[model samples]
Target chain A: MSLVDLSKQVALGIDIGGTNTKFGLVNHRGEILVKGSIPTDEFETPEEFIDALYEKIQPMADEYCEGKEFEGIGVGAPNANYYRGTIEQAPNLPWKGVINFADLMTEKFGKPCKMTNDANAAALGEMMYGAARGMKDFIMITLGTGVGSGIIAGGHLIYGHDGFAGELGHTIVKPGGRKHWSTGSEGSLEAYASATGISITAKKMRAEFPESVLNQYPEEEIDSKTVFECAKQGDPTAIEVFRYTGQKLGEALANFVMFSSPEAILLFGGVIKAGDFILKPAKLHMERNLLPIFRNKVKLVFSELDEADAAILGASALVWEK
Target chain B: MSLVDLSKQVALGIDIGGTNTKFGLVNHRGEILVKGSIPTDEFETPEEFIDALYEKIQPMADEYCEGKEFEGIGVGAPNANYYRGTIEQAPNLPWKGVINFADLMTEKFGKPCKMTNDANAAALGEMMYGAARGMKDFIMITLGTGVGSGIIAGGHLIYGHDGFAGELGHTIVKPGGRKHWSTGSEGSLEAYASATGISITAKKMRAEFPESVLNQYPEEEIDSKTVFECAKQGDPTAIEVFRYTGQKLGEALANFVMFSSPEAILLFGGVIKAGDFILKPAKLHMERNLLPIFRNKVKLVFSELDEADAAILGASALVWEK
Candidate 1:
């Protein structure tokens, strides 16, 4: 591959997901070019995941930015912590010990690097590009398999004292209630609000609506999409499941809005694709639960970033900082 | 007072509260020198409130530091916002419009000035001279009539986009529970956890156990103190109230820990005066509900700052920035 023209001012954005690893070139403005993704194969350990991803990405970097300018690398990954720059015991990737993933990138690419959780990076992405553009303060939530979120206050991602500052998912929405079984993390809206959460709610609704279309779906295969498709088809049980998810989500967000008083909450992830069935209830419930001061004040909007490019753009934006 | 040392760089701390307005002089280290307070007379308007406070405070400043060397002034008020240097409609105070309270002091005192909310000032006080000394990040919750709180991240007060961050008291634990009525703000922890919150719980428990000694006290007069006294006397109702308050407090804080992941949450206010009755249960409930990653990690500690001195010193310290 031709060496990309040297600018020494751009950055590499890397997003590591449960299923795929995405890469892109991003600037400080949150702009990206030449984004691509490769599968994240099941690795027995962290070593294999790192080696496989680096092998796939190194050539792409050489081709895209050959003799081109690049400053640093930024990564967004599950369980990635800004403080530690590692994915610590993340369930999806099958990594246990602290992985110095950023260091590995730096060693291979010889660039300054940074990393944060995918949700947090998405938040940064929105701040720099998508829905929350020009916004200094906002909360970004990725409601996928589980409810995950990030907080930006005063134009910076709030890492709190520890790097784990934006765990809006685990903020208890329902006490003593069945929530996402997040490795023993209890009372999270994630269990009831995410795709996994909707599945759980759908599973419970089986007893409530035994003859519904949901009865046809096997227990192991009941993802949010299946339920959403059923809801789209006017399946009562599926519709009810989405409503229940919104209720829990709205209630949880109302609680979160108090602490951060964000200008808006940018919603991303696969589950939100259900659109108003999920959002209408979530918005109504959120507004219902909010204080008069915050009523109709906090904007809850959907993410505009292409699902695939979000990771790389988010991670790259970190190192692409102006 | 003869011309007080003209060369001394002393900072004036002005803490404006509903009941009274306190002003004190201090060095960089936050040691109180000319400490005093004047009654904050009831006012129908914000101008009147300021006029009344300035009427008394101006003379005192004239008398004490007329010819002495003085630096800047710092003001802490309920609705005060540090970014805009104004106090908006504070819940406790009868003020409505934007009042340049900081400018009022600086113009009168002939010095530079700083201002922030009471909770934020209290947080700063902890950072400077209290239990949070040397701590870069922490949350300060004052369990008074309302559960007011302050957040400091990376050693800076986290005033959100519009300087309206850190409303910890209002984070809802129960969707529509006890605190719903009293504040009329909808499901606030402050309704159930503050001193007045304890009173609310106690009053409800009082009806359940009217035969108890609480019957001797007027229902309206049964405040947090009465409840604490009852707890000291081994009253089951009062004890249960404290336990419940602790549980509620813990749950809310557990949510906060998820977002902030702070080193600790410093408990303050007269409500926390019950000590272990409140702290122990709060700790237990927080631990029980916390995410696994934060199981025994985040510490819950007490504020050692003298309540009066803390706010006063906090206002003073505002001008005495780090």
Candidate 2:
């Protein structure tokens, strides 16, 4: 007990998203040996969630069984916290309040489990594998529903006094604005920045231009992707919407640059699918809004992570890191 | 030499402001035995800066001088970096790029020296002695000509890879709305949120309210204090300006909250003198911009610190911490 030996075992990474819950067995090198996903809505209770997850891993565990060489389990969820080992009222998930998620995982499998928010986990995934490789000080912002943030400083995630550090989405781009759900502002960055948020803004623009090429699509079915496609097809309204979205994202990023002063900020998530539309305006606005010293020095780039595997990788990373 | 056990000695804290250079000799509790200030502009060279400083500190040192007990010096200036031990490109101080300020201090007095930007040092000071005492995670924002920020997470200053982690003032609040000399657009929150920035905004409002009480003051001398005074006298224009500044500040703070998720964000410096005029608006906006769960949870308050001795207390803490 005095001098406890360290383990050289690997870990399991789990990424829980809205549509899917993916699982992966990963090594320290960020390699994914086995990976799979289960429809998230299939499981209701916490026990059921773990039981179903265990069922998926059972076959692979039997095939690659090597005693209990696995060290622990790492999970990345929409609203995960390492310190609390729980998910606190994730907007999408049915779970509410503090859930001893690690304890729940441990109760079922008898293994240590660690977890952090998806954004934070994504940051760790990037650090271990994707774009953030070799970076000791960088930040990851998921441009999805809202601008999710994960901070890395001195080669470690900055989980503050509370487990809920690194919530970049809520930062305001336009004060006293209308409304947006994500990033905590009604008319804040999320209102016009995130995909769902941007789509609504685009919907309004589409309303203004009912005769534009964008009018060809049903408003009810029209989402951000349709807007991006229209922009790619040289539709002026869609392009303007992207430009506005990029500008909002860029403005919000400017504030992040000031707070964390990171070397670079990585981007991920679905809405970034608009890629050029998303990045170009963001870059332009970011450059325009940056301090003289910080201008052109900070890098804002998209994340090249595998969307499906990222969560599992991020979740699995939880075990090894803790 | 085997252990090289560093002596647990006291340090000298020096805070050089625009008007004066305050000095303190003390231990780590942020306490001070003897402290005072000397005019800084009176000196010309680095030699003079050191000479004037030592002259003020020598007597105090003699009183508590244990010969080998005094370890080194820690300084906080408008622009400083502990890593490089220099003051690079300071506007307030005539010093240019990379002045080995610590070396100059050590050369003059045979002791080690450390330095950091004033805001960064203030953050350390707050952690060491001020209201954020003993807190492992917190952010200190100094509201002056431009807002300044210093971040501490997990009991350490978040010095990024480039030693420039905290830069709250430059965080982007406005996307592409305005032009500013300080932070430009790179999302400079100071562009629309800082006291000076707010005043500029208020002055612009004069065109609409030609007969408003604010029009009495010349545009150049107008400031947050005057606006606050007007608000107190029931001037709607001043009230609107305060609300506007607070909203901008709150919006910026919401983004910062996500980044660090500190227990509380401690506000200090000049603009805060307007008190609730700023705090009320900021708090409202912060809550609106904050994650619903984090809403009504984060504490936004003023720094309960001594203006005269804070710099000295913080500077001295630099040495005491080591």
Candidate 3:
């Protein structure tokens, strides 16, 4: 009834990462109208970073949302707390200490803003627009440089008491097993299931198989992509690397399934590009570990969202969610 | 208002256990006006059990709710599906297959009925009347013959897509370590954290220390209670058993904390009777395994509810919750 067309309304989505910070203006139907990117470490302080983000995004908003209402802002960042609206001690971020990200964004843009961790944002995006549409209970696992997760139960993101829940990446799968590179926690899902972990596995397994295509690359360069390509070329060692990674992932998935009993577990980010090389063994081990009541029930599917746009879309989805 | 006094309403609470079935008429203040129990295995079928339960509880309900309104029925049973209102494939129950427990109760009593697994009922009890009275996010662990768990997040039980959620007991803590006696799952939390697991530890550790008081008891007769008694008498072997059990429990608790950042974790049933011996090490290991953000925040406490009355109280809480 008002002058504004609610359907044409757009949200400003921001994804802050270690290397780069991406922002986009997105419509209600998960369409990105305009987007921009900036190096994350270009600014020394969070204040400077906010100013830079505003400089880029404000002009885009003016051009794209001429007839539409701008529906505030939503941000996804590492170590972000939904309850506190702050990013606390993110190891990868340029800014250290607790950054009052939402308040700062709200202040600069003169609009309300909501923020959550990148993993949780991905879950929101999936719930609203992607594979998890109409699903009430599910887990979104991001298998990137580091493993990350967001658990959705009863159609709500479980932010927990402190809004720091759903750290499945840090949940120990192997007690006293592989030590995490940064956190120092032994046998975390991140140590075995992440892209970094896959690379580590490839490097270790390749040592025993000099004939493998994985040996063609130097130890430092033997990453998940290299392993995937080698596996595609019928390298036994590379195949075994993914198989082992999947086994660890599946074991952790079994633990997660038993915890919340989600309808599905959606895998996201770079590592899933390995396709069935990872999914097959992950599914097999997950089934092997689950109890009879839970076995063969939970769907383990890949994310339908494009990796490049997912972060921005997921961040923007938070605005609509609020 | 009508002639009926809402403040004086009473609920019928039933706890269906493997060995015995207990029922009570509980008031709003969690006071049991009348209570009774019957051997669970005495009846061949669920119908017979229900009829017998009805016969015993009907007169008590009449006496207890003489001037008050009876506020339906709430039941806590093994493998109870809250959404389906059924008990499915409970290994210990005489009722082999899926029994429409809530439906049967409703039809028999001519009133509304709700049902959930016993552990979940315990959590409800804690939320309504015990240690977790004002807590919105917490986990309830019942360490009886077998470990059982009920997770409460945002003040609602996570029933998940299926009714069977919060099965933390069966979650693997020490992957490929100790094998569960019944479920045959290896290194489950129940296999290490339960009273049965404690006895197993006690029996195994007692062999290494022949001079310890634990050796006084026959291997077949050794149980959690026996270990607790010996530990109290300063038997090193018995003390080691509790420490080992606590270590395993603590490690699992750390995993749970990372999954759902609850404010507290309330432990119930027989194993907690070891008190500080179990609690101290459990707290230590849980803290040791946790990431910095999660450390020292989660309270690991014993259930404040009287174990004898907890099941009935918890069951009755379902009515009020609804």
Candidate 4:
């Protein structure tokens, strides 16, 4: 009954982003043995990207997995479909139409491959090795370039009818307010609560309050980081920006809580680094808006997964599902 | 091979409302063989209510299930908890605090019993016998005294952590717009789209436009039905009320669809009787608010279940689950 011997299985994890594609070999304990990345825009077609990926990954796979058999491959990408194993019309990606990423990866690596959107992979990562361990129902909200959500109900990720459920970022928080990036919908959660949204909020606040310290920074330099820097220096306008972002996020989180009623909502990625500035207002507003039944029952916490290794671990976790 | 001989099994369905409590003996096919109701306010205590319910239901159970063994009992009440078999601080119920209703009913009838909130029961009923049959992911919205919702994801009703999931009615549709009845939240979906809310909208429109035909009806007489009549007669203000209500509902529904990505959203209860007056505007607004991927994928339709029998059948579906 030696459990140590059984824990030797490993998987290859791939995270395909707009600018770069990161790939790594991950063990059962969520530890990455080796990882590397390539410029995604360097390739014109999905086939070309796959060829470059194979050329780069095969050497790492051979070196890292010399004594162990690679169990499978798991991929996290933009607009990925878990059920169909395809990436369809992803706005950020160069490829058009549907790309059968899993089939191509499986054919190249000679192992089963599973794929899902990045946020969902983060959700799985949290469940497997981070904040959501041993929890059945929770939502993971990633506030990076855009706001993305992965909803887990009854301990299962909800892929819905077309493998595209958990699109909470697109849900409207303020109707007819701010226009969204891709959807063009007014006042979506992404329009106000994302990293880009935070920067936009900072820009708006700078214009509104001419006397504020944020006015010193050029429009291009006034990003989420600059807002944080200004807030640390006790700038009123910069502080208000985080508060506004947090309130919008908190209200949307309340709506999401009412929808699925998850036990906890784990906040992930860049903006969460704002810490109490964002979290305090977000938690306050979420609690304030909740119905009596739901109030005080849900936990709003930052994701515990390591920022650098989370994607690979998350993608590798998908192999365990298989 | 003679399945007809074994098809005589029946279950008791109970729907506990603020004013009245309805009970029925139902078969697997969702047929109510015998049904009756009692004034819920007649009993000051839950024990008294249970006694009266037993008295009325036992006779029906014995008569209808003469040769066939009575299977179980299912109760649908406001603020019911499926996991705990209790009702906690229900606003409309006479009994306050927590009541182990399912255990009480099971103890009283000497049969297995199951209970859930009315909306969740309605969702189960729809999956088993109504518009949601053969569909794994869909939402059921009941627009009666208040707006309530039942969310089905991956073929199971989402009970969340506290057995109080799918409270879509309470989700904010118009921030800081209209105040809700119970929760007192401003601009919740229930505040603008429920039967009560629709009437309130009509009253507000009448006040805004003094020359409108809706001003002819006494304020007290302006119910959903009266609003419908007024709109049919080409009352611009009345028509505007339905349009406003539908827009709010459709926007909220679009948010819900994005969250869960359901195959359809089934509208149930009284307000939906307005038909195209509400449906057309709702459909338009929902499509308008939806993200590009979700725009045409979701179907918005009225529940096909018979209005009178739906509650009982929905309650009975809980037993089938047990």
Candidate 5:
């Protein structure tokens, strides 16, 4: 009823990471008009962090959104609760306890704000702008430093009753298997399927296989990227590392498949760059473990969103979700 | 605007089991006015089964709905597909291959029909008429001859992309632990959590623990009921059987909780009769496995619906869901 053109609206998207924060002004068509970053750990408090973000982003919003109305602000962060609009006890983040993130953002920006966990935001991004476009049901698993997941069903992201659903990374895959380095939870998917987990595997495997190319690198430098490089050069032990990682991932994927029966499982982040070394075994074991009804039906694919801009895009997508 | 009395509407609910087919006329308030059953295995063909079902149900419908309008027919069967409205390759059911169940029901009854798997129906029943009332997110696990599960997220039953979602029973818990009797899948939740699994555990544990009261029972007679009786009589081996089953069930439950973050997990069927013998250990293990944020939050409870009327009530829930 008002004269303001809703079609020319733009949203301010913020991706709050432990090390760095990315902010962008995005249009309705999923295009980022302007973007910038700030080191997240430099701030002593959340208040300081918000001030720093506002200083950098306010000018960009003013410049890029001259004729357009500001839709709102959307944020993605570790341990962020969509229901409570707070970040609670995020191990990776600088914050010590629950921070009323959405309220602070809304107060500073003078606009409505929405927030969810980073994994869930990424899933929303995938659903809106990436491989899962038009898909009503799908799961997004990010195999970065730590494994993270977001589940979507019936064209909506599953926030659970607590706004903390879809913690597939924390789901125990192997009972009494590997001990997680940080959480102390044994046999969780994060203990084996993560980039950190892959590095641990590489170190252990290289110890057993001294002649392998993985041994050529220093213990500190040995990681998923080095393992992938070695596997590309046809190193047997390096290839074996990915096979083992993929087997665990596949077995976990099969369990996930039975739980949600998503049309496809989209893998994202650094570990997915291993390509066929990981994908082939993951596909094989996933199919091997699935029931006859589920077998060969679920598609396993990589995210189509450009990795550099995905976080900002994912955060922005949250604004347009409704 | 149609002038038929909407408040007096009733739905015909059918629960097709492997051994018996139970049907009832249920009102909008989840009250079953009349109910009856027929042997499911006696029929050679699905057509004969449908004819027999019609013969018994049509008269009940007519008597119960003298003034009330017939809303629709709702069927809960093994391997029933909500999307396709078909029953495909159900091992327990007499009919083989895919039977167009919903279409056949509509043609025979001259009413629109809705269908879903029995587990999903039970979940709907629990949501609408039982313990899960007013709960948008909960899981219903049926631990009878086999473990069956239905997941409800955001107040709607999760049918997945293919209408075959929420098969928590088939999700691998033990990895390489136990072989299933029929499916041959190794280490599924069903292999350890079902009543059949309890019997198997009883037989296995009683062998290891010689001089236990479980040793007195014949191998064939040592079912879940027998185990419960022995446990009540202070038999350690029988008690251990429940503990082991509950441990496995709890571990799998933690995985489910992580997947959907349901507020409550409602346990149904014969296995729940073990009471604290299973509940205590299950609670302990489920809590132990969950991440710090999820611990001690999800309420694990038993189904509130009377077992005798649950199936019929659950089937009727589908009709009123919209």
Candidate 6:
């Protein structure tokens, strides 16, 4: 393809994780034409990481945008500030301080750049091209290493006064029940419903049920994925872990439903991979807890995007939306 | 005043309580020019009650509107539907079924009419004339016979797909703790933080401490007001009742702060009259529970409107907003 023709259309989508940095050149429709990744933890500073990412992505952008328009870059990162375009005190990221990520991307790529917390990006992506397409009011919850959320009300993402609205994961699901390791707050939903939560459940279950199938694996090896695998094989202990997690999640979602009354709540991330095992229990508890007006009104579904491409597409949707 | 001139400047605001109905003609500045009331329980039907209200309010509206403008009529009632203008299955109201209240008001008064549940009206009132003026995002919580909430996001009340969003009072504050007498849901905030909840707390405290000053009053007479009186006199048990109520309320508000990240949370209704007794503990617990990003950022305050004029003014705000 000719360089002039390649410059006619496309955007750069980037997802920064604690372990990896994934980037892609995507079309307006969210199709990734080219992609690459780098080890994020290897970088000593955000500037070094950006330099490495630019080196890897430039050739792909050059190849894809030779005859197309070069749209802006969109980034999804932990603790990203959409309004300020900085990543602030992200516990998981190797970078220790506030990083002007969007500005750096704009400077390096010679195009406009925007950034939002990963969950918000996922919500925007779903609104544009995933299950939430055409829906004005919905909540996107990412249940990965930790729980994160983005709320859409009246067709707009609710970024309250400090650009930190929609932190549903921290809302108490079981007040005074379990203490969150980091915040030390009792009964935060993240303590009982996230991937880490599943592992914690496994540990507790292991101590209580010594003869269970989960006992076959070393305690450290029994993560959410392992539990899902065991549940698929009909292990009672593993199944119980998901049941407890779903019950907590469902009850929390019911509270959320009553609070915001969203049209739907879309679940995304690693823990959701348990599929029907988690969904069935969640639906049951949510319906059981909801008031008559909200009962059965909210649709709870897993994300529709392919896991590998979801982050890339989610980031790219920001550019398309603008 | 001339009839045409009266028709150009005023609106009628009506508040329908279970025992009595208060009605008034209010000006654009939220001043009540004239007011009247009718016993609600004496009426056999919603139609009859509405008819009696119209009969009482018509004379005052006519007398004051002789040379003024009558913009519209606005009603605040229990279980009101903003979209359909009906009151549905309000447990406290004398009316047994759905009441087409706004439509009936429009037909009887010969003016455009709008209706919303009392809490929502309070939120709109605050937005238009009270503490929330010029604020786009805030939560108005009415701490009355029962807890109620109205959420404003991006400068608009969030009436969800079913016109019944912002039911924060029903959100679970303590999972599996207290059962709501009406909904049968365990741990709902209304079960702990409302005026009735405070009375309930007083009863428990009275039993636990036989020497409590609250025991002087018969169980039936130990309402929130009596408890407040006792608390002001430094009754330990009475003060403890308010402390616990404030703790529950503060914890729930903290969760809400995380979910929506509002700039402030404005409290209204009877229980708020306790002032620093409730505000102190609520602020302490709310700040303690908040995540680092949200900590100390939210302003928690009581509504600034006068109690007598608030309901009427709240209803009148609907007409102006519309």
Task: Give one digit per residue, the lDDT tens place, for model 4 in A1-322.
Answer: 6454536788888898899888888887778889999999889999899999999989888888887878999999999999899999998899999999899988887999999999999998898889999888999999988988888888888889888998899989899999976678999999998888998889888999998999998878988898999999999999999999999999999999998889999999999888889999999999888898899899998999998888888888888863
Per-residue lDDT tens digits of candidate 6, residues B1-322? 6344433588888888899888888887777899888998899888898788877888887799887888998888888988899999888888788888888888888899998888888898898889998898899999998899999887888777567888888988877878888889888889988988888888988999998889999878988899989999999998999899999999989988988789999999899888888889999889878898999889997898988878888988888874
List TM-scores for all candidates, in order. 0.91, 0.89, 0.97, 0.96, 0.97, 0.91
**Candidate 1, residue B235: lDDT:** 83
What does candidate 4's lDDT look like per residue over B8-57, in tens digits?
Answer: 87878899999999888988888888999999988888988999998988
Find the 10 residues in a row with the least total lDDT in model 3 chain A. A1-10
DockQ of each: 0.65, 0.67, 0.82, 0.77, 0.86, 0.61
Instruction: Kindly report the docking quality category of candidate 6.
Output: medium
Which candidate would rank higher by DockQ, 2 or 4?
A: 4
Report per-candidate TM-score of chain A alone.
0.89, 0.91, 0.97, 0.96, 0.97, 0.93
Off by over 4 Å in 1: A1-8, A29-31, A36-39, A42-52, A216-221, B1-8, B42-69, B210-221
Candidate 2 lDDT over residue span B1-322, tens digit each: 3652234356788888777777877665555766778887877777877887887788788777655377788899876876788887787875557688888889888888888878888888888878988788888888888878888888888877667668887765655556776534533667777777878878887657987799898877678888878889988888888888888788778778867888889998888888888899899877776776567767887887787777777777677554
Model 5 residue pairs with clashes: none
Top TM-score hit: 5
Q: Candidate 2 overall Cα lDDT vs. reference?
A: 0.78
Interface Cα RMSD, each model: 1.6, 2.1, 0.6, 0.7, 0.6, 1.1
Q: Cα deviation in Å at residue A195, candidate 6? A: 1.2
User: What stretches of model 2 exceed 4 Å from their correct place?
Assistant: A1-8, A62-68, A181-184, A207-212, B1-8, B55-59, B176-188, B191-241, B320-322
Top DockQ hit = 5
lDDT of 6 at A199: 97
Write down the lDDT of every candidate, Cα atoms only.
0.80, 0.78, 0.91, 0.89, 0.92, 0.87
RMSD of 5: 1.7
Candidate 1, CAPRI quality class derived from DockQ: medium
| Residue pairs with backbone overlap in model 3 | none
Residue A296 lDDT (model 4): 89
